[model samples]
Target: MNVYAQILIDEAKTRGITVKIIDEEANLYRLCYGNNSVLCRESLTEKTCAMAMTICDDKSLTHRILYKSGLRVPRQAIYINMTQAIDLMQTWNSLVIKPASGEQGRGITVDVREKEELQQAIKSASKYSEHILLEEFVHGRDLRIIVIDHKFVAAIERKPAFIIGDGASTIRQLVKKKNKALIQTTGGESQIPINTETERVIHHRNFSWEDVLPHEQELQVCKTANYHTGGTIIDVTDEVSYTLRTAAEKASHVLNIPVVGLDFLVPDFSGDDYVIIEANERPGLANHEPQPTAERFIDFLFPETKK
Candidate 1:
């Protein structure tokens, strides 16, 4: 079973609910407690409204809706062709290009500053979605807030993959060692990719794969702060300010989604300034350990089971 399915099953079993796997390939399952039962696919349950899911899946629509609701969101434009994408890039020197309907940071290119890079980003993003979005690149910490029933459940700050030098090994060797440790830490869910992207980032920093980093120096390997893409997650549930929590809750309420993850680009956790990046209808509950995300999800699913 997938990690998420296992977490949900374990949580349900603790509440004396009968758990059964309906489909292994799809990670589909069913949970029953007495006469009450619910069918779920991963973290998404039957209770999750289909309309809300649709709105969250489309990035352009999500930005439009949130912008209209008087919520702060980054400037964004959707384009279907290379010409349109390049023209949009002229407004901002640095832009983030991503698929309109994609997840897990797949087919996303960030911090694209040049026209050549922008063309490449558009081509890469086109693989996952026909419609692509170009948004002004905002520099801030990547924050993820899990809201259940319009209430804040958990928060995390995701950082890009990086490694500290010991003044001995090359960048390539350090990446290998780091990836091994990461696999053990995340059960192989995350690992830094040693590809063209990694190479570009290293070269831009005036370093090469064969070059040795100085002792105690930290070098970032990836650009996107995605957990599945070699990023690390730090639980910040206790640190999230009330202002940020209120904004996330309001976004969930506006979207009419009982369960959602609001991604934000915030200057800091203590400040009120932020831009809503996107809304995830079925946010991963397995990653936020020690935060009671799974427990809250179960509570939302079966309130009677709550202790």
Candidate 2:
């Protein structure tokens, strides 16, 4: 079972709710609190409309809907052909290429500046979906805001995967230790992949796996701030500004989804300026630990249980 699903089940058990495993393979479960029951496939429930889920699945459509609703979004365009993609890169200088209907930051390439890099990025994204999105790379803190029942419940900032030097270990040794720690922390769900991507990032910084980093030197191992790709999550619910909270709530209202996660690139959490990057229909309730995310989700589904 996914860690998030287990967390929900544990939370339900604490609330005196009856729980049954309907499908262990899919992590589907049935939870009953009194006469009220809900069938949940992960964090998604029947309360989320099919149409809203569909809209959130397509990145291009999500951007268009949010943009048309007067929300600030990054300049983006669909990748039609290599010629068009190159044209966009030449104009923007740096672009992010990813599958239009993918999640968990899979098959995403960021900061593509050259024609060759853009072509490679498209090929990478093509493996996941034929449809691709090319957008101007926006630089800012990656913030994920969780909205449940049309209200902001939690906010977190995701940072790229990085390793701190201990002055005694090689980069490869440090990575192995880091991965082990991550596995222990996330219950074997998340780890940093030591692959070409990791090598490329380190190579760009004039380092290698065999090289020893100085004490206290921080090295970013990946560019994308995705939890699945070894990114770190830091809770910022108490620090998020009203503007960001309001914007995320408005997005949930526009989509009419009872629960959603909004991704934004913001210069500062306290500032009003931000760019809506995407929307997630079934956000990871487990990612925001010790924040009552699963509790809020259960409450949203079974409000009668709330005191």
Candidate 3:
């Protein structure tokens, strides 16, 4: 079983649902619970939720339909050629480049505010995608609204996971130490990649990897808050508020997708203004742990069990 499938099995057990995993092949497995069975189906997975989730993953199609239905999403331009990227860059001063079918913020570059930077961002983002998503960068806190069975389950703020400084260790040392802790934290499913951007941030602050760390209370390195880039996920279930919930519900209904992950940028959820930057299908369940998205997914699949 893949890591995600394992998470589903683990969560199902936690929820008092008896499940059996049967191997159909070396890499394929089937999940059975009571009379209901889910096979190793790939639209990411073969289950009902996964199929619904698939509709949201192909961002180009999702946005096209959702936009017509009056759902809030960033103004997006899809390009398969570098010329088109350059053309779009000339018109938009600030934009973000992302894979049309990417997740976990992988291959996402934000704040390309200049021509050269935009080109480079486009090149990098396009490596993982044939069709690239070039969008106006929405400035606000990143909010993840997870919908299960057409209802909101929970929300999280993915603060870019980073290492804190202790005013003693070097930046390299700090990163190495944090990577070790992260492996322990996520069961070795992810790692932090050292990069020039991280080094440049360190150097810009008059420090090098070998120098003492930044002030304990200050943010010294990196700007992007992505889990794949070593960002943290904070539970903000209560903060999603009623207004945001209503908007998310409306957005989901408009899209006609049963399961979807909506990403928002807003100064405050209590306020009336916000931007729906993107909606994701196959949102990584591991990001929202203890809440058990997989369990919620199972419940969604087996709603008859509720009655």
Computed on alpha carbons, the lDDT of every model, listed in order, comes to 0.88, 0.89, 0.69
Tens digit per residue, CA lDDT, model 2, 270-303: 9899999989987888889778888888788778
User: If ranked by lDDT, best first, what sequence of candidates would result?
Assistant: 2, 1, 3
Q: Give the Cα error of residue 173 in candidate 1, in Å.
A: 2.3
Task: Give residue 177's error in model 2 in angstroms.
Answer: 2.4
Model 2 regions lying over 4 Å from their true place:
none
Question: What is the RMSD of candidate 3?
Answer: 3.6
Per-residue C-alpha lDDT of model 3 across residues 200-280, encoded as one tens digit per residue? 446656877787665674544555666666777888877777878888888777666656678888888666667777787
Q: Count the backbone clashes (under 3 Å) in each candidate.
A: 0, 0, 7
* Superposed model 3: Cα runs more than 4 Å off: 1-7, 14-18, 22-29, 40-54, 80-92, 196-211, 289-295
Q: What is the lDDT of residue 134 in candidate 1?
A: 92
What TM-score number comes out for model 3? 0.81
